[model samples]
Target: MMLSELSRFGLDPFLKMRHMQDDMNRLLSGLGTATAQAFPPINLWLGENSVVVTAELPGLSCDDVDVTVREDTLTLQGKREPKVEGENAAWHRRERAYGSFSRSVQLPFRVDPDQVQARFADGRLEIELQRPEADRPKKIQIKAA
Candidate 1:
């Protein structure tokens, strides 16, 4: 009988391997390695005149985050503090990540730094960036032959 057929009898050898892999992944996730995903994932939208960005920051407040726009790049930097627990408390599982994180995105066009606006509410951040007048496309009139 094939090894794959053992799954039908509830004796799959691969099941043990899968459980070991999960255990290893959980143990290594706490190391804060580059393989981990970026915190506070973001969504970006580009419009004819402006760009909008929204980021999910579940445990962060406005004071913890900083937004900056320079020419064609937008940077989001923030820190999440670990929750304090009692001295006798023991942890069985911890998946949430804490510490400083910075994410920078390059915009499609140059933005007017003065026209940038940001708002943070309900653990979410929204930023609006207006394209610079000089960087916007201009319509040229066609001459009749």
Candidate 2:
């Protein structure tokens, strides 16, 4: 009754391999796929006392996005749309990505929630968070007798 039920009759190795890869990619894509072609490609870097997050947010002005920091997690969420303003021509290929995306990442250290700062430049949103003062290391001085 099913096509797979007849695979034993004529199974092609190449087709089977391609199908397997496609299935796996579908599974991973559901779990927050991060690809270059995907909308809002995000990059996160952790430092000793800070975490820097950079996301590609094309067509978004400084006011279109918002950055929120809570506990040791950093969340980036935004939306984009495709707009047409000029006379349309025969469309051959359109590769620009537009959609709503959200990503939350855990930092290596507890940050100062009140002192967090976010800036957008050249279509990239950068978030800089300061670590808690109490969590930073201190230097001790030695005394001679």
Superposing all C-alpha atoms, what RMSD in Å does each candidate have to the true structure?
9.3, 11.6
> What TM-score fits each model?
0.75, 0.61
Lowest-scoring 10 consecutive residues by lDDT in candidate 1?
Answer: 31-40
Q: lDDT tens digits, residues 43-119, model 1?
A: 99999989999999998999999998898999999899999999999999999999999999898889999999999
Which ten residues in a row are the worst by lDDT in model 2? 32-41
Q: Which residue pairs in model 1 clash with each other?
A: none
Steric clash pairs (candidate 2): none
Tens digit of lDDT per residue, candidate 2, span 1-145? 4667567778655697899999999788778655655446778787877778788887898777767788788877777777664686666777776677677778877889898888898898888888998988788898998
Evaluate model 2: give its TM-score. 0.61
Question: What does the lDDT come to for candidate 1?
Answer: 0.91
